[model samples]
Target: MTIGIALLTLLHILIPIYWLGGDLGAFYSSTFMTDPKRTVGERMMALKILNNIDMAPRTTLILAFPTGFALAWAKGWLAVPGFAVVIAAVAFLGWLALAWAVHLNHGGGAGIKRLDIAIRYGVLIALALTGIAGVAGDVAIPFFIALKLCIMACCIGLGLIVRRQLVPLFGAIRTMTSTGPTAETDAIIAAVNGRARISVLTLWALVLIASFLGIATPV
Candidate 1:
């Protein structure tokens, strides 16, 4: 029990650091990626860096659920079965495998990307439902944990928005890189990047809010 709590606590503490650090890297890379003054190769390199950094936060986000849940159960805040931690660990490991497989394959490998996306949406819905259930007295949950779950759900939702925003940004980038940069391609890149940054900022706000709530627990 002592070891479990210590490990879970450490895992929880590391998550925000992992998330924000990776996101900041990607955010910085985006500037270079969108800069038309840079050579196409340089911009492509930036894009590659951004994509690599992105995997960090994405992995952290998936692990956050199991880590948080296991921590809660370990601390006696949740009344789940004793095997719950094992189940959570298994789930986390499975998701982690799928996530890395998708990454290593460069988003290929027989629907792994699709499965990963489905997992995100499924987790988003599950977290939201759990929060609602706890609040509505269908399940017993501590106030802070329930609120944290909801905050997490919001983070996932914002992440989805960020993902969608990146699509057009990457498309414009591919156009510029593959066919040589044109005025039209540069304009599209700039526009898409600008709009995508808004979503990124929003996601950052959610991360900060979640961090604050976890730390302060004022509510």
Candidate 2:
């Protein structure tokens, strides 16, 4: 049990490192990808790199919940039953599989993307409600853990918002590829990038806040 707790704690710690670091890389790559001054092929290469780098953060986000849950259980911070842990493990595996599938088959995985988005919405709502309830003393969750849950929900929400905002950018990319870059497409790309920056920065702040919560475990 000691070994298990140590391992779980280590994983929980590493998650933020990958999540924030990977996102930083992806964010950097996107600047090059959306730069109209760059050749289309060059921009496309950057996009490829961004997508690959983004997988780390995406995977980490999915793992965060289960990893945190397991850690809490191991430390006796949460009274999670053995069967509940097993169920969570199963659900995490399924969600991870779906996320990877969508990433790998992005071009033709509209249905999968939709389903994944729906699942995210559900998780976001659950996390938010649970966090709020726990904080309000209506649930048995630890205050720090519940606070982290709310932060996680905010991160997930911002991710979804970024995705929605990127739709126009993606369409602009498609237009640039199919019809060559026009001022209109360039404007769209630049505009979307500018807008998405806010959410990205907010995500970084939220990640930092969550990291602090994990480290400090404030009362």
True-structure RMSD, every candidate: 1.8, 1.3
Clashing pairs in 1: none
Q: Which candidate achieves the best lDDT against the true structure? A: 2
Number of clashing residue pairs, candidate 1 = 0
For residues 28-85, could you state the per-residue lDDT of candidate 1 as single tens digits? 9989977879999998999899999999898888888888888878777888997977
Residue 150 CA displacement from its true place in model 2, Å: 0.8
* Candidate 2 collision pairs: none
Residue 34 in model 2: shift from native, Å? 2.1
**Candidate 2: tens digits of C-alpha lDDT, residues 164-219:** 89889888888988988899998998899889989989999999999999889876
